[model samples]
Target chain A: MSDVIKLAHGDGGKFTNELIKNLFYRHFRNRKLEEGIDAATFSVNEGRMAFTTDSFVVKPIFFYGGDIGKLAVCGSINDLAVSGAKPLYLSASFIIEEGFPIDKLEAIVRSMGDTCTRAGVNIITGDTKVVEKGSVDGIFINTSGVGIIESNYKMKTIESGDQIIVTGTIGEHGTAIAIQRYDIKVKGNFKSDCNPLNGITENIQDLYPYIKIMKDPTRGGLVTILNELAELAGLGVRLIEEKIPVSREVKAMNEMLGLDPLYMACEGRMVLVVNKLYAEKVLNRIRSLEGCKDANIIGNFDQEASLKVYIENYLGGKRILNTLEGAMLPRIC
Target chain B: MSDVIKLAHGDGGKFTNELIKNLFYRHFRNRKLEEGIDAATFSVNEGRMAFTTDSFVVKPIFFYGGDIGKLAVCGSINDLAVSGAKPLYLSASFIIEEGFPIDKLEAIVRSMGDTCTRAGVNIITGDTKVVEKGSVDGIFINTSGVGIIESNYKMKTIESGDQIIVTGTIGEHGTAIAIQRYDIKVKGNFKSDCNPLNGITENIQDLYPYIKIMKDPTRGGLVTILNELAELAGLGVRLIEEKIPVSREVKAMNEMLGLDPLYMACEGRMVLVVNKLYAEKVLNRIRSLEGCKDANIIGNFDQEASLKVYIENYLGGKRILNTLEGAMLPRIC
Candidate 1:
């Protein structure tokens, strides 16, 4: 009932009940959640299910394009989507600092609700914990999701000539957060690319057979995932430096900040490894999807056993791309 | 590779990979987890499933009996167990403050792995994030669990004559944490009653037909849960004070601290609402299990339309037991 959160709100008493009933229940209402006392029960068919969890602790709760709420929902949803599963139910747990404004909390909850609705997923069960002032920065959210895996989708084996394609331009999210965190005044529209990728993934369902693996480049961005893929496949990556998609604004901002776009994060983009035979078709299909106008074939797995990732320029100069080493940016989710 | 966790460890790059492979993978080794990339995929039968989540920010990460790792796993397991489900899989996410010692994190992870191994559940997928030093106190853990609901168990409707039973003694957990937090000098083996309740729940499966509902009295303890059940069933609760189970040490600690045992928390206990005809049988069955010697039928739903909870002493003295109000103990979990 207070304007800001109190320690009593997490005491599992009247205040806790009020907060749950008024804010969480009111926003995340569903049949399973309403009937649930301790856990939400639902029926699942005989099939494979995907489960994943992520926590968002970005420095500024509200950012240029999205807030922590949207990021939390999209992060988990994207994980399941990239794993070839249709996102279904999610559990949200929050650790809130005492004295946080009720309005701010409501706004965050509203954002999560809106995103879930847009993504066609439900927040079935959740828990809330409030700590003393200064114990936590402001609020941190952890979302775990369950999704039913499609039977037709299976990760194909990677080969020497497998092509790598990116769904969109890189580094928008990390650049926006970096600018905001450093309080650097920028001119152009520099906002996070934090959108749900389920739409794009579902649209490219027909290409599942030709796709070896798909990953959402979130933290440690494009180059980091490329390194992971190269290591996993026991092969080397050959990137055409000019083929990598980077928006002009993101490129300029990274130049100004002296940060590599390759290591920066992206919230709503996918990196897909496709069979060489269908690589062009997959690129065309992804480019037709909304928000994927810049889709392109960035590189291909080399036939070498080096187990390294590198970029080659037009003049044939090659440079190794290492996995992100130390902390480039903290709390840049 | 340092003595303490660095922001780079959460960067989702080389250091993050090393942390996962060396620490997380080594402890939480399972087929599904080892094969998982973005999400863990598993098969499920055609049945109802239970899902739950909890975040543990308990102060004094290491308590008299257990640490935060054990608490986090047990808290989520108990939630699913009380819902008449067999706990199966869990996802763990951690938010650690920079400068926290690596050995402590490993100890916590080892405790979690040990608990999950004992409870027969798997930590299939997880995420780790490290914030700036002052952003968080030390560490916080969030665990979300999924379990399959047993086909034979169904929640029967509550009636006025239903009986209420507790599986073990109350207030041990809260009392133990209070003593540790406030540094109260007492001459007794004061420790938290933090243990997984699945063992007891599984042992009492034969009595599921007569069980109306089950709840773990974790935060607000027995009285708070009684109030909730009374409100839900639209009936009053008449608790027999002498019939309730309380450990001698817990009683002594509460008396010295001037805290009400009725409002204290218990971690490894269950408050079951059962049919009156089988209440005695349920009590006997629970008493025969491990660590449940104190099981007793403490109260029964009153044959009144008034929705309230009260206690009746042996002398016929009665007092209303309202839901807990305000902050009693912060971060007691």
Candidate 2:
């Protein structure tokens, strides 16, 4: 059941079949994705479309709560989802190193298929290439997605006094990947926040039309996302540090590693900027989703000239959040 | 001017600037690309769209006639082109190794920008990430493109008696890459056939409204492509070996390496299956293009039961061209 992949795995033959079935299908089994075809097929209602592409090269294929395959699918789908579009199709391309395990590749592909099915998208077309052993790392996946948005459903821009809300906690994905990568042991259990955010976006979009910008706090985390929005909108943002909601485990780990949780990456969480009047309804709608039950308003936009991000401390002191100079955790995504 | 890449090349600052200016922009300079913005913005006629994504990790980044950057842009554009689409926008993502030369990365990006401009496409958005030295090779590029296809244009399937034509010679790309990779010495000069095929496709589409199928021979080469088409159409194909043109140098090199020229990859060339009546016109149109001046009719489809592909040799012998058993040249694309 576990053998290192030979070049035959990519040869489009029996070995490729075994790899797809045994490893990939094993972990990513789902009802709609059982059809083993070159591309998954589906239909969509008429609408204008939005599309996005993302590649996952996370060092360890399998990490805390998710693997590279799952991450690849979710990351791409979520990107399309937050752009106010209903993700419909995805194309996957793989670059596998020569000696990567066929079992591992299968697991990754199956997981990706299952993730797409859950997100209600089809894997329509794909390409696979193999490189010599030293040329590449284990495997790298590039996924491009297409989503349809009804012509009328344009999300507006963030304005002064708009509430900025986050779905659940932050820093979980970064911490999880970091810990698993370094094999660090902690007293409490830790898992990645690497779930899809489509459901929450769907819920909020259904209830209120006043929600402004929505973005996943990925690479530079909540702080960087806020900074980017501030600069784009020519505004400032203020948040209450105590109410920002970081788990004790993440905080402790950040302290241990001399890192800041605010700068960590979160795979599944998103920041929503909404009109102040609709913030309550949006929060309630988001709370009904499974992974976003802890949704909270983290900050508000301000019309300040400085264009800075400030967090009000528990002791009532304001601290500035600066953009990260370099990636805190290199290949976490 | 030629030096090994250093870490500062990917720092997103001063060194990155000089690298882009000297090596890449100097060679591929164009007005739109010179703006040096994160995304290139442009306009297109209104229509439904076809989109595609591709990543290039060809080893020795710099190949015979082209480098990874040009290949990445050309590959994505070609995918859109063959789909009967008018390519408009592209997004490039770069994953740079820690010590890659800033100059090289800049040169590559500029080359990519130039390629996009020549193909009448723009780089609309991009993401850049840097990994530790050992985590990645020199640099890997992922490009996603969106193209506008005329609503009236539909891709047609190949039918029996369709004449298959190949643009120019085959195996030039594979032989060139292989020669550089293995350090093979050949008496005659050789260069990779790595130009974009969108222009040639445009000319053909303009003349023939009924071109059945079009495909570029890349990773698995011409034989695999023919086999795929055969399987898709549930028919057999008969190719005349002498009529299938290849440069003498390439043929000599193939014999030297114990390789078959028919199984080698070609980037710029394409195999087109057209209704027999239009074959001559299509070949003439392709020949009118500078690089495809030698386009020739090489084979024809047949309604045989076996779905096999065969080549008639000069010695009056017929040889089966089977699906490639394994990758003949990894990363040839």
Candidate 3:
């Protein structure tokens, strides 16, 4: 056992087996992962299942709030959870650079195991491949998740008179990663907002019938996601700028960095579109949850207007917001 | 729309959406992928299911017989297939280096879509991430497959007295990749035997009752796999070297390069451990197929011997083979 990953670890040989047994299997211990077979087998309930994948190329493997491990688990599971499915199983694959530290790898893997445990999901099967030292920067993780959607828990799409909800404070993840990557001097406990939404997804199922759409705005952030949703629903969205929650620290960082918090990624937050009548109920339920105290009703889409997003300012001025064009931030999630 | 990938392509903005719509959607051409949601939801039958994932980082993206794209598709599908599951759906995640050519990406993607078409599987959902030029090599593909296994079609594991049958010639894939990467001269055509095994898995259900264990010999090749299977099953294996099939070109290349064909990789090959009584019947069935034309009974394990692999040579001499340690080849798959 070397201290750093070597090419032999990915050669589909003895070393690879030991790495899987020691690191991945030790952390994500379960019957399927313990099998160490070519694939994992499990009996899934008959129903519509959500299938999604997200690659974690976050620059610094370890950020303030979470590392790539937690991000990988939460990102993939959230996709399924937000889609109104009970996040069940996940397959993780890692592409590691030669000479990467084994200790760091173990820490990342343990973080993933802890996340999966809290989320009540399993990392059933996985693959590990080590490339030349320079071929990859450090390590990249790709997680794909599968979840069964009970018919009773299916969430529908948004319509006119729907109310929008931002689950928590915005831009924390982007702010955290930026400080780590850019070395920003000022920092006041602004770590990433990365976590599994299974908590909210499970509790909100009580009102699932009234829920329209649920999405976690990760990459292009809240503004861009709202624009996409508006276009898809063929409506205009009006947002109360003040109601959009951005922590004082995150706002200060965003202002100083000349970055829009609306366009900043939040790994663990979800935007919910619910029937206006039940919006308050959904918000109250989410607000009582562990990671969603800041949940609030933002605004609703206008059925009359075209596909556009308008944000009303504190001074009573309204401005049009458009979809993100160029890449704003890379490898933030 | 640009000729080369820009950082914005993975920025989760306008460019990322366009790249996915144009390249992935145009090639995969499926309704689920077209849904363009956070995750794809499909109804699957209730049963024991198989899930597997693999990441492809082969150098020289394109080589004889197949490119990385084809390898990604077949490799993932083959895992489920070898597990005796009907390959159903796959989610592909790509990590492409910035500035990679658009045409090449399109070709690789089209190859993937085409492979899915031939394999009768769909690329339901996928994620695309682009990193800085130096962060990764040309491109890497991570595919996770979900397949449904009926009660009858489920494959079993190896048992002593079970016969070992190889689907086709060995070392062709490793040899083909080597010649392309190392610029080896004086070589006959040595193309990789890369392909999906869904066809065989589906058609072999009738014999599933007798199929003890089936595994695709990829990296670390046949010898290493035999060593693994022997230890896992707690039995001893004896292979007849003269009976094992190897193309003359591959054999010559292995000799010239001081590599063992038994340990050379194969993308589309499988090692089946079946009831010795039905071994011949299964080999004949596989031999009648296109890719499995060279399928043959290579050897069997002895019930009473220790966990070791003994390969009988052309001169009736036998030698013990051990597990693979250091990497003989890196990034070959």
Candidate 4:
């Protein structure tokens, strides 16, 4: 394939078909994705539940480790997962710019189909619109997902003495995208933490039903999510800076960019607030997963304050962590 | 307000509130919208039906007479309505660029709510993500709409001898956006035909239940839609150019741009192919609607040698109307 895209890719003709078959399907091969229908269909346990929708418009459609198609499917599935729901179906809509290489568009769609298949979700419907050159920048994807949450499992607030856990290393996704954008070279190895968290959520929820809140630290990162949890629960959060996991490469990249690692995005990670007693159990369960081998309890909820997030340094210094005023690494998700 | 946008607009704070109340809420004033909730929920008649999603990334955000927000809501709703469904719930997702004015974002959201209300649909769910500057243009909106189509209404092929009618005018949306892009001036007035068409579809469907196909010519225009219908039904479409209504202003603008009015997009207009015997009644019913005063019978389906779209020129010469290989006006939705 050429380094750049052409308009023939979005034509929905011969080139579009070949592109899907070769690049995207090869990586994201799955049974449901092979159907090649507009949408994937599957059964769900009967219930009325919340359905959410989201779109991915990240620049450089293809990033360091993941592309926009993969992001679209995984990001939407994560939203449903955090809502305490089992993602069932997904609908994708594409607004492709004219002159985008057909091969690229196919690669994106095939990757999307593969990602959804791995998540055990169906892409049941989709619409495609082609815009002329200059009107759009390459391609943008929108996905709407429907999931069923068990009526018994209602998302609740974290109480005092609850533990806060990070699924894995933070700032991988953000650092990866940033490095790609700036063309920065780092000595150490790094990979984007881009993976679906539904299976892990399912395993944990099946074991401990009292998981108070679950959030994927994406756009605003761990700092923003923790603040939201504190504000929602009307409690204070105390985090141990040392306990929170971060790769040396990610930290160095952040420092180089004069950025806060806490504000950087992570796609394959999650923050969970559970009773302190089950904190160890939750951490162990998450660690058993493929991508969450470094899961750890980094903080606990405090009853004294209304809505505050404090990070304790290794030298016994405490600093307040504020909610992100604006996006730190926008469109990282 | 400053021309350059700031981060506070998306903060969900005072500046964001002011932006909503002053700019967006002022233009799109409505009760449900004024609530300022994350989502607006409403009930609909329960049934098994079709659900679709669409996103509008129209450049310049605001065009001739309409904006991206209005198009987002109306586009998805129209898709459902044309599919023989009663438009119901909608979900809107936004990807706002960092530094975008909060006022602009709020204006888009409020317009979406107002447009949904006018179309008799509810905004049930939504999502917001902010990207860093340079990642995306101003703003992009993704809307997923769920609608209930009566079990009795089947969207199948139209039989031979079915009469095809177009509501109001064609090419208005495309012409308006093009003129704005090129800064072209016309003596006669030209307005974007960006009104919602649920009412017109409802009235025409009520009058002629045998309406075989209904589609709003938005991106590919009327010619592409006719070609699709003809190909699907294995028939030919014959159109009379003299009967197809085109505003004088749009004609002049098309001439100036060297664009074909037949291939130009129309946001508010729809093409309906009905049984020949009920064609007049359907035409009368559409003409009685507020925005469909100029509805007329402009074509018919024929069992010809090939599934082609033939247009009868004003001088009585016949020419083949082909599908647009590329978008006429990018992001004109």
- The clash numbers for all candidates, in the given order, read 0, 9, 0, 10
Model 4, span A165-271: residue lDDT tens = 99999988888888877788766777778888888878876655657778888776898788867877889989999999998888888898988889888888888
- Pairs in clash, predicted candidate 1: none
Instruction: Return the lDDT, model 3, position B104.
Output: 97
TM-score of chain B of each: 0.97, 0.88, 0.97, 0.88
- Considering lDDT, where higher is better, how would the candidates rank from best to worst? 1, 3, 2, 4
User: After superposing candidate 1, which stretches have Cα over 4 Å from the reference?
Assistant: none
Tens digit of per-residue lDDT, candidate 4, span B1-333: 544355544433334455556765565555544644322323333355556777676767887767999888888888777776677667777767767776676667777767877888776666665555754667878888766665355555688889999988888988888888887665566778887777776765565467777788876678877887887789999999988999888887788789988888888998988889989988888888898888889989988827999998878999999876555655665
How high is the lDDT of residue B84 in model 3?
75
Distance from true position, residue A169, model 3, in Å?
A: 0.7
lDDT tens digits, residues A1-333, model 1? 899999999988888888988998888877777775788888999899999999999879899999999999999999999999999999999999999999999999989989999999999999889999999999999999999997467887789999999999999899989999999987998889998888988888888989999999888899888888888898999999999999898898898888999999999999999999999999999999999999999999997738889999999999998875686798987
Stronger candidate by DockQ (1 vs 4): 1
lDDT of 3 by residue, A44-129 (tens): 76778889988889989999989999999999999998888889999999999999999999999999999999999999999999
- The worst-scoring run of ten residues by lDDT in candidate 1 chain B lies at B149-158
Instruction: Report the C-alpha lDDT of model 3 over B197-314, residue by residue, as the tens digit.
Output: 8887777778888888888888988998888889888899999998899999899888888888888888888888889899989989988887788889999998666888998888
Q: Candidate 2 regions off by >4 Å?
A: A8-48, A151-158, A206-209, A303-305, B1-48, B151-160, B206-209, B303-305
By DockQ thresholds, what CAPRI class is model 1?
high
**Candidate 3 backbone collisions, by pair:** none
Better of 1 and 2 by lDDT: 1
Residues B99-125, candidate 1: write the lDDT tens digits. 999999999999999999999999999
lDDT of 2 by residue, B242-312 (tens): 89989999998989888888988887888888889988988888888978877899989999736999999
User: Which stretches of candidate 3 lie above 4 Å from their native place?
Assistant: A151-157, B151-159, B303-305
